[model samples]
Target: MKQGIHPDYHPVVFMDTTTGFKFLSGSTKSSQETVEWEDGNSYPLIRMEITSDSHPFYTGRQKFTQADGRVDRFNKKYGFTNKD
Candidate 1:
């Protein structure tokens, strides 16, 4: 590990804008905003548009489309059967 060459890694808060969910994590990114965490310590605040808390997939609001495969659809359309 080289010294003075690595980016500064520090604790920061990531907040989901939509859900207002916040979590503490380490990041090299910096911001002018600051927040006091539950641990009674202040860390840099980073605002995010989306996170696991508000994401459709993570929130169980994601839609799964079961589309037929191209080959299967083509075979079915032409009435083709596998000989093997």
Candidate 2:
């Protein structure tokens, strides 16, 4: 461990711009923005374009590739029927 060589670790707020979700965590990153937390204290606010709250993978809203309808064309060409 070294002294005076590490970035300051402090509580920071990460805000999801799309979902308006806020998360509090410790970070060495700094921001010029600030926000009042629920604890009645202000913390550095970092605005993010994407987070778990709005991410497709995390929200289970992922958009699957259509494969250019190749599967359907193959099935039709082979006269194959899909079984439910």
Candidate 3:
């Protein structure tokens, strides 16, 4: 451990924009944006698109992807008929 060679580890907040949720954690990252936490202290706020709170997979909210169109397109390109 070298002195003055490591990044400053400080308490930070991660804010989920999609869910409007926030959690306090520690990191070496800093930000110009600040928010008042429930503890009554202001900390740097980091906004993220995906978090465990709002992620579809973790939340058990699955989204369906249409593969039928792609299969049809591939079959049409190769002149394969859906005879079945």
Candidate 4:
């Protein structure tokens, strides 16, 4: 590994804005914000809009699309209707 060419990798705290969940992980990304973690040490804080904690898929809150309505619209456009 080259010494001066590589970016500094250090512990970073990722905070979910919605759920307020925080986790520490190593990253090359830098931040002007700092947060004191559970270990009583400060690390660079990164704010995220969505994380596994607040994501729809991970939280099992996924919304179902109305494909049936779309199919009806497509048929109507082509002058076709459902047989049954």
Candidate 5:
């Protein structure tokens, strides 16, 4: 609650690269990029690699680690005796 003690919470735009989706929001995070929003205003742009807009989990296409042939290879390399 002191002056100059808290970081600035200003307008920011998060851009999704994979989906090319952008939205206007506010945050304390800092960035050097500037972008003109759809409302005809400019704000600091924060480029994000992943978000709900283009995430595999939200899209229901998530991929998991392949455990079928990996277990045999791991056991052969490290001599794991436990099979169960």
Candidate 6:
């Protein structure tokens, strides 16, 4: 642990731009914007385009494409039928 060698880790508010969700977390990143947290304290506000709150995967809103196996695709493409 060298002095003045590590970046400052402090509490910051991460905001999800899409959902307007905010959460307090420690980060090395800094921002000029600030926000008042629920704890009656002000912290740096970091705006994010996507977070767990709004991400499709995390929210279970992700759309999955139907996929066919290689064999099935080949058979469908060439009009091949299984003999067995």
Best candidate according to lDDT:
2
Candidate 3 residues lying further than 4 Å off, grouped into runs, are: 63-84
Best by TM-score: 6
Candidate 6: residue pairs that collide: none
Give the runs in model 1 whose Cα sits over 4 Å from its true position.
Answer: 62-84
User: How many clashes in candidate 2?
Assistant: 0
Name the better of 1 and 2 by lDDT. 2
What is the per-residue lDDT of model 5 for residues 1-84, given as tens digits with 9 covering 90 to 100?
689899989999999987889988889997888999988998999998888887888988653444556887889899888758
lDDT for each residue of candidate 6 in 1-84, tens digit (9 for 90 to 100): 789999999999999987899999999999999999999999999999989997778998853432346668889899999799
Segments of candidate 5 deviating more than 4 angstroms: 63-84
Clashing pairs in 1: none
lDDT of 4 by residue, 16-78 (tens): 998899999999998999999999999999999999997888998853355577878899899
- Model 5: weakest 10-residue lDDT segment is 60-69
Locate the minimum summed-lDDT window of 10 residues in model 4.
62-71
Error of 6 at 47 (Å): 0.3
RMSD of 1: 8.9
Assess each prediction's global lDDT (C-alpha) against the native. 0.88, 0.91, 0.90, 0.90, 0.85, 0.90
TM-score of 2: 0.70
Model 3: residue 55 alpha-carbon error in angstroms: 1.7
Better of 3 and 6 by TM-score: 6
Q: What is the TM-score of each candidate against the true structure?
A: 0.69, 0.70, 0.70, 0.68, 0.67, 0.71
